[model samples]
Target: MILKKGQLSDAILILLILLFLFTPLGFYAKVQLMRLFSFAPSIEKQETSQKLTDYNWQLVDVEGNQSNFSINRGEVIIINHWATWCPPCIAEMPSLVALHEDYGEKVRFIFLANDDSEKVRSYLNKKDYAIPVFFENTQTPTALKASSLPTTYILDKKGNIVLKEIGAADWNAKAVKDLLDTLLVEH
Candidate 1:
């Protein structure tokens, strides 16, 4: 049977539309279309390294005592970069404390505040938490290059980064616990 011109054109158009919406190529096409319409791509997180040596983070204790990362080199370290003003960071404080209670001795948990040490002390003064606190004026760690607040860096015993998470997360979650367990085993 012979098809009319309009029918054949409609069939081809349907095929193209389906192909344009169902694959990786389709996603690219959508991106290109949005670009042509003057839309910008969503911002992506900056990539960070997974090696502890990549970042020379200064160490500290709850009393704001300065130290070296080497002191905790032989143990797994959970480096939490936080600020008092950050709501999510504040919200995750209890979870972090709970995490410390469960694995504090096994792993070296450090809460590195990007604010003044006094500010951190004042904040913790009201809480019954037991996590060690430290202060870092310059927040440039190779393993944690995140420009966002509430970033948690999980480092192995040798200080190598095992995982980097941005935004607030339940530290007691199984995924996080499993990852920390693996790092502890490596230690």
Candidate 2:
């Protein structure tokens, strides 16, 4: 077959795109893209947000200590549902860790695992993350149930879900910090 210069360049470009889309490198690439483009989640108006009726989710830590969501019921909480294999979750983890490091004393952070306990432990250990992680011991609360991987809920002191993000977001953004600080003081 005869090929012209433009056709050859187009074929090479297509081949490169195909390789990038199919190889393991694609995973890393997607994670980088997600991190690069993620934004802070929008705040929900108090009048329009969902309030939790119960805070009694049964959960177990990686070390198998049983816990209940009621422990954090009256505090500002950040509950993130994530899996080790989810690219968006991985992408948002660094920022989330940073946020937790700064607010751990003032707010409770829950890194909910949707994957196997051993795998979640290994992944967090490999990444040197000290965030608290939990696995469902019995059942998750309806308010805390995530409809998708990488979902996150920011709850105010009264159990009002102030922010519910369904995908990757920059949890370390200034607006998020401001919101947390504001939520910390409200009655």
Best-fitting candidate, measured by lDDT? 2
| Model 1 per-residue lDDT tens digits across residues 1-187 | 8889999999999888888877656655654453344311122233434566644556666664667665776788787888876656775666678888888888888787778777777778877566788766445565556578778877777766666767666676656667667767763
TM-score of each: 0.66, 0.89
True lDDT of residue 62, candidate 1: 61
Q: What is the TM-score of candidate 1?
A: 0.66
TM-score of 2: 0.89
Identify the candidate with maximal TM-score.
2
* Cα lDDT, all candidates: 0.68, 0.90
Task: Report the C-alpha lDDT of model 2 over 132-151, residue by residue, as the tens digit.
Answer: 99998877788778989999
Model 2 CA deviation exceeding 4 Å by range:
1-19, 44-46
lDDT of 1 at 118: 72
